[model samples]
Target: MATLQQTEHNKTVDAKNFSRRAALGGLLFPAVGLFLGGCTRGLTTAAAPKVAIPEGRGAFALRADGTRAFRNHELVDQNGVKVRFQDDLVEGKVFGATFQYAKCEGICSDMTQQMKKSYQLMKPIMGKPVNFYMFSLAGDSPAEMKAFMQAHGIDNLPSWRFFTGSSEAIADIRWAFGFGDPNEETDKNLAGHTGMVRFCNHKLDKWAACPAQGSPESTARLVVRLFPSNERPQLAGIASKIATPSYPMKNWSPAKPLTANLASQL
Candidate 1:
């Protein structure tokens, strides 16, 4: 009687296992299809941002908001000087724009470092004209902006432009560029907020922004094709040399030790 009971239990277990396998197999394709559909829907759901400033390199273009941008909105430069966004626009080219504050202790810092790495990656063509604009969402005060430039070694770098306006004005600018994170309340870490690199296409009047918190390099590469002066600077030539095998313009390499260390706490 004991042996018969044990055999019956084994048979029951085998039947259950087979049924589960069959069910899971039947669900696999549908599950995969749903996942892919969700991703596709997510990407195409929103219209790409438009260029609102109509006077500068993108004067003829429209922003994601379907509005034209001003040539130079009142923004403070890294030197604490009020400068126009189109002050240094090179005719016939698109550019990349993003916002960051100097005092940012979290994602902002990483974002800067990432752009710096990207700048290094494209260093060989430093003198040539390509648009790269960075605005300080915080608008570090004139004194703060001056000090921040020195601290970060951007005191002489002309390739990047920083800007800041009033809190309300900045919010409008952020919305125009799609910079601020919408669901900021739930994010516990720096990356929890929305962060993206905006690439403005002057000719097409379109832009592409990336949200992957770790993909600035890829974003840089996408822009690199537009500006192909392919000479990378050496570490020794930098204003301050870094120890890693950092390809000069590629300031944020695949591994940024400082950023990597910070990632642990995030």
Candidate 2:
């Protein structure tokens, strides 16, 4: 019975982790299962409003420089402003983007912690015009969001905006940021899927997916250091991984060559 209980406990923990992962990609595939395209969420950035960051989980990265994904889409920031590539989304400053919700307890929370560390590292590099936008999967009210932000001591960061929108709107917008797939449906809400951050020049038409955590400046410096590195290794080292075949993404193919080396990274 004790052994059975231990096994049960392990199963519970595993289930929770799986739920969190599914939540990260909840918008992608709203079905129950571990395999198939059951990734964190097979985010697709189509015609949606560009999933709001502070709460909604979805795409934030721009596609290849010349990619069409870079040309379309718009996002609303904390100041109640609608922003996009061709718009006043901050022209010269480095910007950061992430996804979270007002009441996340698991991976979303962990992502925020990592995000904060990354933002702090990039703080000096950002200020006026240099901004950070975190979209909410919840589309929480501004009043509630502001209060919570202030409580967390995040109010002083004038340039950082926590954004959210109608749940349905965000579900559609997630496609633009590639953070979640909005096509599927289930009893579970959008809160489950978490997404990656993207650092953009704001002036360029391109978007690059960011690392899970670490300062953006640090990440930037690392990228520069790795400039000569083949794009393959750079992507391999930076992009977060999910068990493939089960995961969803258009740009990266599972680094089948990863083997034991990839396992260590995980």
Clashes per candidate (backbone, < 3 Å): 20, 33
Q: In model 1, how large is the Cα lDDT of residue 201? A: 41
Q: Give the TM-score of candidate 1.
A: 0.50
**Overall lDDT per candidate, in order of appearance:** 0.46, 0.45
lDDT of 2 by residue, 38-58 (tens): 001112333433422332232
Q: Please write out the lDDT profile of model 1 over residues 118-188, one tens digit for every residue.
A: 66665554434445666565546766665666676665665566666665445444444544322223312
Scored by lDDT, model 1 comes in at: 0.46
For model 1, the run of ten residues with the poorest summed lDDT: 32-41
RMSD from true fold, candidate 2: 17.7
Least well predicted 10-residue stretch by lDDT in candidate 2: 33-42
Which segments of candidate 1 are over 4 A away from where they belong? 1-72, 86-93, 180-193, 211-217, 225-266
Give the distance in Å from residue 228's predicted Cα in candidate 1 to where it truly belongs: 11
Error of 2 at 194 (Å): 1.9
